[model samples]
Target: MATVVLPRSLVALFPGAEHRVEVGEVGSVSGAIDALEARWPGLRDRLVEAGPSIREYINVFVDGEPAALTTPVPPRATVHVLPAVAGG
Candidate 1:
């Protein structure tokens, strides 16, 4: 999980409504989605895209650094995905 630590601002987005996450494997985002979906069925549709590419305003991080949207999943990495905040 590369010691995943959630940013304080984005706590409520997680389905768990508890701890954020620590996705250790990048390729396993789908796997994680599946797992989370099992727990909270609504989560899969809310999080993952039905086809390809994650939804907009969402960013993933690896190793405490920004992971490009085009970057393929890395092995044994850390991923933190959160929605972009905006107010106008």
Candidate 2:
């Protein structure tokens, strides 16, 4: 399992989850969403989308770099997902 840190907003989505993980390279963000959907079928409809652009309000990182929206993530890694809120 990967150790994931999520912003407060997203934390609500993963109720009772202490950490987060996807199926690894065989999967991607889509996979994570898939897995979550499998468990809570209503989840995918809320968390994922497909269009000309992904939502700009989010910033998902893996090992501190921006994560691939479609790239596969490995298990046993660290990931962070947060809203793109910033200010001077």
Candidate 3:
């Protein structure tokens, strides 16, 4: 199982917004997100677009390295999902 870490922004949608979850048998970043969505409905939509691709303003990281939706997720990897922040 991979450990998925969600940002505080998205966590608000959930009851506890605990911000962390463990997903099983995920092969890629998208799969990790799928697992999260399965547990928390509507979560995936907040990160993906019509292409089922990661949204432009959203960033994903695997073990501290920037990654894309297709990025392979090795077993027990840690996936981090964060929304981009901008300020002037």
Task: Provide TM-scores for the models.
Answer: 0.53, 0.62, 0.90
Ranking by lDDT: 3, 2, 1
Model 2's number of clashes is 0
lDDT of 3 by residue, 1-77 (tens): 78999988789887665688889779999998888888888888899999768999999999999998899999989
Model 2 lDDT per residue over 1-88, tens place:
6555545665566576434544344346656556655655565555455672335676667667777557556776566666787789
List CA RMSD, all candidates: 4.0, 3.2, 1.2
Residue 30 in model 2: lDDT = 58
Candidate 2 off by > 4 Å = 13-26, 86-88
What lDDT score belongs to each candidate, Candidate 1 first?
0.54, 0.58, 0.88
Residue 53 alpha-carbon offset, candidate 1, angstroms: 1.9
Q: 25-66, model 1: which lDDT tens digit per residue? A: 536455555545565556556555646556666665655666
Candidate 3 clashes: the total is: 0
How badly does each model clash, as a count of residue pairs? 0, 0, 0
